[model samples]
Target: MELRQLAVFVAVAEELSFTRAAARLSVVQSAVSAAVRTLERELGAELLIRSTHHVALSDAGRVLLPEARATLAAAQEARHAVEQQRGGLRGTIHLGILQVLRDHPVSAARVIAALHARHPGIAVEPRQAGSAVMADDVRHGRLDAAYLALPSQQAGLTLHGLSEEPMVFVCPPDHPLAGRAALTLADVAGEPFVDTPEHWGTRIFSDLAYSAAGLAREIRYEIGDLGGVAAFVQSGLGVAILPPGMIDPVASVTTVPLTDAPLFRISLAVPAGRPTGAVTRRLVETALELRDRTPTPAG
Candidate 1:
């Protein structure tokens, strides 16, 4: 019923622990519990199933979570609009960034710096995670927006294409496939490959590529960081398929063009069909501008 109550409920639903939610909101645990109880009484429905050790969203809670998020976003947008009219935007933008963008031209640091320079009153909180997890976070209202790689279309999120780079084949210099002028998925189908874990954007893209080509490849090494893939390949543990920017030139690995390479597409994802706050909009614009200024990586 009340905005404060809804805020408390959202925090508890997200953290799934009264103590953690109270800590996050900087409020006492009793206050958090009181707010949730008031909300439940007003709604005439149980929102969360609480136990001593765990809390899970009930069916009604799951149904109300997205609506609560939308309502909160709308309220924030209204406040931000009024704040902008008065002077400057003042709010926090929870941003999700990809782990593999450290070496890329559209660096997250650059984007954040630009946002800060433009809107000094706004605060940007950045969290690094794999693209899939970031996307999910954005959809669930945990993150205001995210810079991530999109392997495919995601529901409940709007993706603004930032950059697209073709994947390259990486292997040791002396490897058999290293001498090839170019390679295809079929060419590397039988070779041992090194890649990120299944949930990572790179792995999902690679898997989709192989699946589309009706091919299956063996993954001998699964590295978490894109930077580490080169090391695995340099040691002759296995080969890799990654965007050109991800391959370390200084490493002992060789990068060959992929004739049928899958494109690694980066995008800015935000929740679809909802109003975004001024801070979130400004951050999105900053990211897009930075992406435009940075030259695309050559295949």
Candidate 2:
């Protein structure tokens, strides 16, 4: 009938003696007897058998022991959950964002704004990183979470795919194939290519696409700076393969669809096999909400 009564019943059931149960609960024996009598009357069943020499459970007591224990455990868990909520999601979330996502700054801002408005106690520190390093940073504790372009499997991280951004080929307007609707990686295999460094997230997918096509890309320039890749292609330095949304709109550079380009899958990656902190969980939820509401590609 009541949590205290159930707790008292459990103690008596386990100990099999009111005197022992009272001692275990640090209460007087008569008080324990009175509590059990009240519980039995409420349940309309006798719960214990008592004789001068021994104490034993009646049928009702045996049947209710496990259920009583369960009720107490559930009540304790409920209290813990409330206490945790009262504590607030108050902490710093060491977050990392992919350099390419910087192109869609509004989505990033919206996620942070929603998180802060709902849980003002959470502080977000966002830093830019190449997709290749985002997963490793999160797994190694250098970051709490990150928006990453993850490979199919990351050993020590959990990846939640948010959006798939298509890749395109960027070439100077005068390039022979610039006006084409779409072309495969093989078509541009021999062209002078401006690409990201080998360690970049974009480079990983590009390399896999080229490898699948059995094409050896002629990388004329490998840019370390994220902005330099588009700059090089726009200046007639070389053709580049990149997410169309990530590239700044340039009249001099024509974005041709790539038939075989791999779609960049953006995901929220967190360390695997650990309890996520309250603030980190809130960030993940907000990011998911934003991801679902935003369009995949920029107009």
Candidate 3:
């Protein structure tokens, strides 16, 4: 009935002698006999034929040997898997994020690759959605956690600021302000502007920068995606203030820093009261490490 009993049974069944099985198991011959006898009684079958000169399997012994061996093997494998999970990590980590990271291209792949390297059994599943929706899902237990630009104040969410990336203004290289050492938000006041949708987290930095500079907002157009906003500016349609992740398509656009704005913030979001397990914490930490290691784009 017990795994130990089955283990002894398999050893005795294979060796066909309690004396040899005891040597293999590092137990006394009498103890081995007692263990095998206990197994026989629990199974309600006589498992061996033994006399003064020899030992052999009974019909019931032959029938149960293979099954007993199989059971012990399976139990050992299950124990190993459980131990691995307890000591290292093994399971799927459901990760959620917003458009900025979802479209970042290397972001998810990098984090997943790191998980694979460090713990092959830890599977990373990346999901993308709006920031508010990201929070809602984590709060409801739909997702384990997320890398999102945190809102100013949100109940039921714990935000950890991993790092901050300063926002920059993008314009055609030939634009008048592109040559400045550093520009203020007021300097771009009247320039036709293209930026992320006002609902986006980065928009808070943009709006706050404009308000502090006392510039009337004059946006030529609003785009939901930063890539699109970058492209629009490269084509000379307008200027845009964007985060670093949006700098990929800059054949013609010039990015200049806003010396007086709050840049942008990076934070991890998890349900305040939900328990964060080991795998969940690793995924979040991996995300933050990925951002910190991002390569500076070539000019």
Best by lDDT: 1
For candidate 1, lDDT tens digit of each residue in 136-245? 78875678899888764789899988788999888899999778898888988899988998878888889999999999899988988877888888888899998876
Residue 173 lDDT in candidate 3: 91
Worst-scoring 10-residue span by lDDT in model 3: 97-106
Q: How well does each candidate superpose onto the true structure, as a TM-score?
A: 0.86, 0.68, 0.61
The best-first sequence of candidates by lDDT reads: 1, 2, 3
RMSD of 3: 19.5
Off by over 4 Å in 3: 1-88, 98-106, 151-153, 212-214, 288-299
Give the TM-score (vs. native) of candidate 1.
0.86
Would you list the C-alpha lDDT of every candidate in the order shown? 0.85, 0.78, 0.72
Q: Give all candidate RMSDs, comma-separated.
A: 3.0, 16.0, 19.5
Best of the candidates, TM-score: 1
Q: Give RMSD (Å) of candidate 2 vs. truth.
A: 16.0
lDDT of 2 by residue, 202-290 (tens): 88878888888777978889997657887888788998888765676644588898877788777888878545665677799988877
Quality of model 3 by C-alpha lDDT: 0.72
lDDT of 1: 0.85
lDDT at 262 for candidate 1? 92
